[model samples]
Each structure stands twice: as structure tokens, then as C-alpha cells.
Target: MNDYYGSVPLEEYEQILSNREYWDNISGEWEMCSKMEDKLVRLGTFVQRGGDLNRVIALYAGGREYTYRVTIQHCIERYLEALTNKRVDNLKLRLFKLEKEEAVKLLSEMLKVSIGVDFRYDKYTSRQVSFGVLDTRWLDAEGILTAIEQEHRQAHHDESVEEVRKRAHTWIGDSWW
Candidate 1:
């Protein structure tokens, strides 16, 4: 069952802690990608909000070799319109085409060297590739809620019910409700 944060089993608190450690490692790596994504998104926003495309292009010109990242960044920059019009994927394709073919080809090579992750896309299809970069390794809403529940269960098992309730109240001391 899922709660706001999700439930974890009482028996699995230790395992969950270990899992959290693993997730933390993945999250650390994702932090860098997320920052880059944010920067690109902001640049995209600037362009869409009456900023010069020439300047935008110039700012990113030298970085074209990182075509997929640049494309995703540009797409994020125009996120509202692209999302509203269901054109984000299309925009990605357009941006992909703008890249030198060799750079696109070299994407796999770059991924191998940098993150050890693979580029997963078929170039023949005109569909825009969703950048698989994720900031959080744990994105499943249900799973998260379940994990939270599990933690609560573990705490309940480990402590008396009154203690648990007291801790909760202490954490939210002076609550109106």
C-alpha cells in the first residue's frame, strides 16, 4: 500500500537503509546531470522569453558536440510551449538534426567514457528521444510511499506505540490540529 511517502516492511528496515545508501550514490551522480539540465532549461527559457536566438545559439555553439544534452536543454528552455503543444519530442528531433552526424554517432562513445550508460534510441524513427537523465534514482511514487510506510512500520516495531506517538508530536511540537 502507498502513503504519501510509501511503506516499507518492518523486517526490511535494515535492507531499506542499505537500499537508501545505494540510491544515495546514484543520486550523487544524478545531481551533476540535474544541474546541467537546469542550466540548459534556463537558457531555453531565456530564448523563449524574447531573448535573441543568435546569442542563444552562440552561447551554445561550441557545445554542439554534446548534441543530445544541448537538445534536451533547449527543449526544456521552451518547456511550456513544447509540453502544451506536445512538441517536446519533435523539438528534440529538430535539435538532433542540427547536430553534426558524427557527434550524434559519438554519443554512445561519450556515454561509455563518462557515465558508463548507454544511449538508447533508433535514429531511423523521427520520434524525439526522451533524455533518460534522471535526478533521483527513485522516481516511483508508489514505491516511495511504500518505503515510507515500511519505515514507520519498522519504527513501530522497534518502539512502543506511545513512544512513536510522542516522537511524532515532538517533531511537530505546537501543531494547531
Candidate 2:
């Protein structure tokens, strides 16, 4: 056999994305939204660590898209839960499963209003082109680092759901909530 030690083909990435059994197997372990958030950080770090964006997009399109999409989705879910004191499963469903344009619109609206972050598709495309930090415009480098550190600390400590809800309210304030 010829030596073939290159990145996996894009077709393989598409196959993996389409494999229902593969996703089902992995989905069980991600019941907690925090786990998905952690994965997003790791993936962001991977891109930041000089990982080739085109290669990443080629080899793991689903992963790249999922990380970006799920991070925003989970954040929105947490914020909505804190605001309404009610879980927002339908919002999560829309964020996770809707068509790309619609989902991006919703995410952009939420990020803009909630965090003063501008969510732009062009920024995402530029990051892919340059292999820069994925969607870093939402938060500066320092802010991103702080957020990641806080997330890690929270993950290690088991806080009740209600406590997290309360903290979110304090974080955004009752006027916004």
C-alpha cells in the first residue's frame, strides 16, 4: 500500500456528519450543556493553536459548525432560563435544528441584545480564511480567556441548577431578565 498520511477527505467529514448512529452514541455523554460549552472552548483553542482552518473545515465540518452553534445556543438557553425562570427547550430546539440562516439570525439577535456582541457571518468566514480565533469578535481575547476560565471553575464545582439560574439573573440584571 502506498503511504498516505494526510488529512481525512471532506467526504469522510460529510459521512460522519450524516451518520445518525455516530451522533446518537456521542449525544448521551453531552446531556449537560456545560459539556458542550467546554467542547466549544477546546475547539476554539484548537483553532487558536495554529490548527489549519481549511483543514479543520474539511476534516470536521460538523464539529466546527456544531461548536459555534451550540455555544451560542447554550448561552441563550441559560440566559432565557434565568430571565423567565422557565426552561426554554423550544428555543434550544430552534437553535440546534433550524436551517442555518434562521438559526444564525436568532443567535445574532440574542448575542447582540444580551451581551453587546456583534455576531457576523463575515467574521466567521474571515476566521476560517485566516485561521484566527473562531468568532473572537464576540469577545476580545482577554474576555474570552476570562470566560473560559470561569467556565472551567464552574464545571469542577457542582452547583445546583437553581443556583446557576440565580447567578445568571445577577449577571444580566433583572431589567434585562
Model 2: weakest 10-residue lDDT segment is: 1-10
In order of listing, the candidates' clash counts read 16, 0
Q: Which candidate tops lDDT?
A: 2
lDDT of 1 by residue, 79-124 (tens): 2232233443433333232222222222212222222112446468
Q: Which one wins on TM-score?
A: 2
What are the RMSDs of all candidates, in order?
A: 22.6, 16.9
TM-score against truth, every candidate? 0.20, 0.23
TM-score, model 2 to reference: 0.23
The residue ranges of model 1 lying beyond 4 angstroms of the native Cα positions read 1-31, 35-41, 48-50, 63-82, 85-177
lDDT of 2 by residue, 1-177 (tens): 111111335444334323222122234434433343333333333323333323332333354444333333344345334333457653443233222233323333332322211223446447322111123244332243244445545664665657546544432322111
